[model samples]
Target: MTLPSLLKRALADLWNDLGTHMLTTVVIFLSALIFSFFSLIYFNLQNFVEHFGTELGLVIYLNKATPQDRIPALYQKLAGLEGVQAVVYISPDAAFKRLASYLKDEKDVLKGVDPKFLPPSFELRINRAVFHLDRLKRLAEKINRWPEVTKVQYGQEWLNKLKRFSVLLRAVVLISGLLLVLSSAFVVSNTIKLTVYAREQEMEILRLVGATNGFIQGPFLIEAFFQGLLGSGLALAFLYAGYRYVETLMGASCLLKGVNISFLPWTFIGIILFGSIFLCVSGTALAMRRFLRL
Candidate 1:
């Protein structure tokens, strides 16, 4: 049969069982929405991690006994280190000023504080190409052993926590996404099976009249395709609406003050839509295989 004829048959069959088809679509819609929600969270979190990585650097404090003349040499040595993009020396006075700036209105707390007590430090910006926790730790350890260095800090605890969180989130998204996909396919398969069973006698009649399996399966597959398209489309729309609402609400609060949480990109959106359609089609094919014994 022609494409148009197949589509017409599919639409008629769906119309005949409108309630069941709508319910099936709704189920698929919910599944897709949840899966997309997880994906969006994962995407934003990964982006944040990468952004943090780009800004990741080490701060090495110099001992008070370290001579001011030795600072230039120390800076040169640090700049030569692997993964060191740049090295900037912050003198005690500059460090004190930075502290005061951070304190803003609370600067009164530093009225009795002396800049001489503040240690001079080297700020080392790391190269993104060589950025890694292990490498950073090694660099820090090596720097800390220097006679002029008092301490080396790169927010190790915070970085470690962020890394662990990213890994855990990824695992959760993957495991949950897999479970959701399987469950969705199972639901779609069962729903299609019901439709197939209802038309078993008709399909048998067509088969006896020498109809090819492809010809018999075309309409059901098309029906499944429509179900997937509609369900996924609606899911995305709803997800986007929810995303905007949350974004707007968060914008007015300090919760995500400096953070920008974005919606799923176009590429991810396309993938979800395609995956949903493929999932439904595969489910329908499975149903056809079992019921029609093809």
Candidate 2:
């Protein structure tokens, strides 16, 4: 048959089972929507984890009796240290002010302590490219031995735990995504199987007439492609509406706290749509393989 005739036959067959095709499409769309939702959450969590990790650094406290004239020299030394990005000095008054802000709910407690009791400190940010736990620990120990230095503190244990949790989150996302894809593919394949089974007689006839398996499967694949496209489109629309409703409810609260709540990026949306199309095509091919065994 000519190319036009082949396409005409494929279109006719696909049109004959509109109801079943549509049902399959809806199932595929829902699956894609769920996957995209999970991905959106994963990306946000990943962003938070990275930000927290990058902000992790050491705080160096100077002795309370340390002279003010020596601070600039100490600051210069710290700034010149290898792996140190910058050192910001915090005066006793500033420290006390921050303490008050942190304990604002219990203002009466601050009345008991003198602001002079607060020591000066330096916030040390390290070069991210050279950050190493062992190296940081050794540097902290060395700094602690300085005559003017009271202590060097970094949340080493907490940072280790945070890093581990980030790894665990990635693993969980990967496993969950794989399971979702497999389950979605299974459901789509079963749905396509029904259509293939219904056309068994036609497929057999085409096979007997020397038509290749590709020719016989062309219409089914075409139908699946359209089903994937339409399903993903519908899914995206619903996701957008749901996201808007959620934003209206929570966006203000997040912004008030200087936090940002965001939805999935357009790139990811594209991935979901293309992934849905791929899944449907794969499912249809798998279904055809079994039925076209003759």
Candidate 3:
């Protein structure tokens, strides 16, 4: 049969089997839901990593009496250090100003507090790749050993625990997403198998009249493809709507800010769409293998 004629028959078969096709749609929706949840977590973890690389809280506070000219040499030295990305000098006056602005509404409470209370500090940012806690703390210790340096800090145990927690959660999310994808494929295949079984007699009649296996199988293949594409389209729509809802609710939080939390990426969408179609085709192919002997 010509491609057009075969496609027409496939559409008719799909319409006749809409009851069975709905199960595949359900599977797609479930898979999409799972993808959205995992994607959000992964994106947030990546954002936190970026903040550590640039806006890190590693502060090297200098002694209050450290001279102005000495600051430049320290900044230059720190910037050229092994793993440093950049070193920003914050004079005591600037630090005091920031402290005052941050507590702008508390001016009455700051009446007797001198700006000298705030230390002259240098903020350190480093390359993300070299940011292991042991190396960073060791670097900080080396700097503090100098008589000019008062202290060095980078969240110590807090950073350590956050890194570990993020790693663990990422692993769990990856495993969960993989399991959901596999389950959806299995469900789609089973649904396709049922449809093939239901239409076995029609397939047999075509074969009896000298139809080739290709002719007998062409319509089923097309129907399976249509079902998969339709289901995938539905899943994408639902996933996008959910993203909008979450963004609205979490707009005040940086967790979703600057992170593209929309529908899954096109690459992922393609994977899901093609994956469903492949599952259906394989399911139909294997089911017909048994009964094609007739």
Candidate 4:
């Protein structure tokens, strides 16, 4: 069939079967939307986990009488170490300043506590990529041996748990999303098959009349594809609306006092659209295969 003729037939088919096609498309679209939203969330959570892990390390607290002049030398000693990337010194005065600044919002409480009571410390950030754990531990031990070194804080037990959980969470999210997408495709496929069955006699007659394979099934395939596209588009619209609504309602909630997460980036948005297209295509192909045989 000519392109124009095929397109005309396709449009007519879609119009005639609008009700059923619409339902199939809507189902697939909804599936894609739910999958995209949770996948976005999973990626964001993985980012959070990595950032948290990167910040994990030792906090070396210095002794009360550690002289100001020796602070730089101590810092240099640690900085020059094989595993140490950089050393940030927090003097007693600086520590007090940070504490006071944090408590500044509570004026009454800020006035009561002496900031001088806070200890001087070094915020040690190591190059874990190059730093051997045993060597780093030894350096910490050497630093702690000094009379002017009060304590050494190293190794968080939660590191393993956090990493493991992040992996598990991503796996769960992906698997669940995939299974749901398949279920949606199945629903859509069955819907399209029923729509095709409604006009099975007409299809057989076209076959008997020597209609080309493309000529006979092209309209049905086109109709199925249109449904999938329309459904996915609606689902995307709904997801965006719901995301915006939730952000507005809970933007200032107390539960997220420390979290500063945002919605998925534009790349993810593109991925969602592409993923929707793929699901729609797959469902259409499956439904059309069965219908074509019948």
> TM-scores for all candidates?
0.87, 0.74, 0.79, 0.70
lDDT of 3 by residue, 114-226 (tens): 87787788998878766666788788899989788989988776667767777887887788878877887678777777888888788878888999888888888887777
Best of the candidates, lDDT:
1
Worst 10 residues of 1 by lDDT: 47-56
Q: For residues 1-294, could you state the per-residue lDDT of candidate 4 as single tens digits?
A: 887788798898878777876777768777877776777677767666555544656689988777889898988877887767778988777887787787777646656677678889998887756544455557778888978788987664565566577678788878978898779867876786787678878878887888767877777666665666676667667877877777766677788645555677778767666666666666666655754663
List the candidate 4 regions with Cα displacement exceeding 4 Å: 50-58, 63-70, 73-87, 100-118, 124-165, 250-259, 265-267, 290-294
The 0-to-1 C-alpha lDDT of every candidate, in the order given, reads: 0.87, 0.80, 0.76, 0.72
Model 1 / residue 292 / CA error / Å = 4.4
RMSD of each: 2.6, 4.3, 3.8, 5.3
What lDDT, from 0 to 1, does candidate 1 have? 0.87
lDDT of 1 at 233: 94
Q: Candidates ranked by lDDT, best first?
A: 1, 2, 3, 4
**Worst-scoring 10-residue span by lDDT in model 3:** 256-265
Residue 47 error, candidate 2, Å: 1.1
**If ranked by TM-score, best first, what sequence of candidates would result?**
1, 3, 2, 4
Number of clashing residue pairs, candidate 2: 0
